[model samples]
Target: MGNGTRLGRVRGLGSAHEGAGEWWKHKVSSGSNLLLTLWLMVSVALLPAYDFATIAGWIAQPLVAVPLILLVLSVTHHFRHGLQVVIEDYQHDESRFVLIVLLEYFTITVRVLAIFSILKIAFTTTGVAA
Candidate 1:
């Protein structure tokens, strides 16, 4: 009501018009994670064996690989969002920025390694060692 808008002086007000998008993203990722987790359990349960050959062959299929990749991405995103809210809520000091940055870097690194491993197994592995 003074020389600036409420957000400029109120601090943390109105969500900076970003809360809805972040909320929706978090919820969507959660839903995807649940569905993919169910798929994983059922798929593995239906397998003939839990051996390396059996699992590798299953992941090599396009249908399986795609969903597995999606699951990885979704889980990574959900983890990031969940941690971000925690950081935002409990951390009020300047360290919050550093923590958030580190969180993002960590999530990215984990996601890349996970996806790469999945792809490698799906494409390069021969299912079982000779």
Candidate 2:
């Protein structure tokens, strides 16, 4: 028989078999977030100036754009995963599914917007106006 108590077996409320994967994902994402945040802070601090032109030129670099995209993606994924855990634990059954769906949509929307902005800046010519 399964390791759970008799009542757990009777109620069929045992493990869903997904928690470990989610936990590991959260850990990895947290680590990435720390590193990326430090990178962003140091990079910005070292910048010659924060004007539109200077910042745009900085983002236009391949190295800067790639890490910025990674930072956006990692942060959003971690956000959604963390919120999903909270919603699953505290939210009522009737509302949990809805909240998770909404969270996913919000995360995706923000991530896409940020990535798109980075890509636009990375690919555009420095001489272009607008």
Candidate 3:
């Protein structure tokens, strides 16, 4: 419950109790990102061609689109968590909060755009046919 024999323990001042959860999340996201990225690479490598329409049509399938979206989510989550750790560890200036805010906003915006593009491709062409 306490860190070492620091006197802050008796005064009820100690760890914030948030690091473990954050660490777990980073690990989970990292694992998912690895698997999803490999899936993406294999899927693309097996494609007949890398042309735009061909790629878009491939993404049009629900099976492909869902995993692609998941990849985006996992990558962005990993990205933000990694950067936030850097900012938290090295950024001691007053602007740290601002940087964190900007990081969150950037991550959210990227996630939204990526998901939108995938969904747009997935829903185009036909409702049931890819």
Candidate 4:
């Protein structure tokens, strides 16, 4: 039952399609994540006490609102990109492709909605409309 080898029958297998751009995007995303994480950690640590009204006021401040919203957006974006890459690498198939695209779009939409919500909160606190 020994046919020596199957190497001679192997054909048409192409190389992977990964590019340098994906790697660069991942690096940039990681860097942004690191910065955002640091900001979040430091902000949480600076709070001596966490009360509902106190926290609301902090979130309303322009200084805190802008960075906090940015951090959330950046982190969400990074997460979506990283997960998409992981899915691309590990999942290979047409159905998976459609699912991955849907997932990415959903995550991005959620990120935008979250940022809008944060902006709404900040604006409301400052007594502004729209």
Q: Provide the TM-score for each candidate, comma-separated.
A: 0.81, 0.82, 0.82, 0.74
Alpha carbon deviation, residue 101, candidate 1 (Å):
0.4
User: lDDT by residue for model 1 over 2-117, one digit each (tens)?
Assistant: 35676555654333567789899999998999999999998888888878887888888878889999999999999998999999899987778799999999999999998998
RMSD each, Å: 3.6, 4.0, 4.4, 7.2
Candidate 4 lDDT over residue span 1-130, tens digit each: 2433355225313433455776777688788889878987988888766886667677888888888888877777777767777776787766557867888888879888888877877877753211
Q: For residues 1-130, what per-residue lDDT tens digits would candidate 2 score against the true structure?
A: 5678978756545777888999999999999999999999999999988889888988888888899999998999899999998997898655887899999999999999999999988788476322
Residue 6, candidate 2: how far off, in angstroms?
16
Q: Each candidate: what lDDT?
A: 0.86, 0.87, 0.86, 0.73
Pairs in clash, predicted candidate 3: none
Candidate 1 stretches with Cα past 4 Å from truth are 1-14, 127-130
RMSD of candidate 3 to the truth, in angstroms, is: 4.4
* Model 3 lDDT per residue over 60-111, tens place: 9878999999999999999998999899789776677789999999999999
Off by over 4 Å in 3: 1-15, 126-130
Candidate 1 local distance difference test against the native: 0.86
lDDT-sorted candidate list, best first? 2, 1, 3, 4
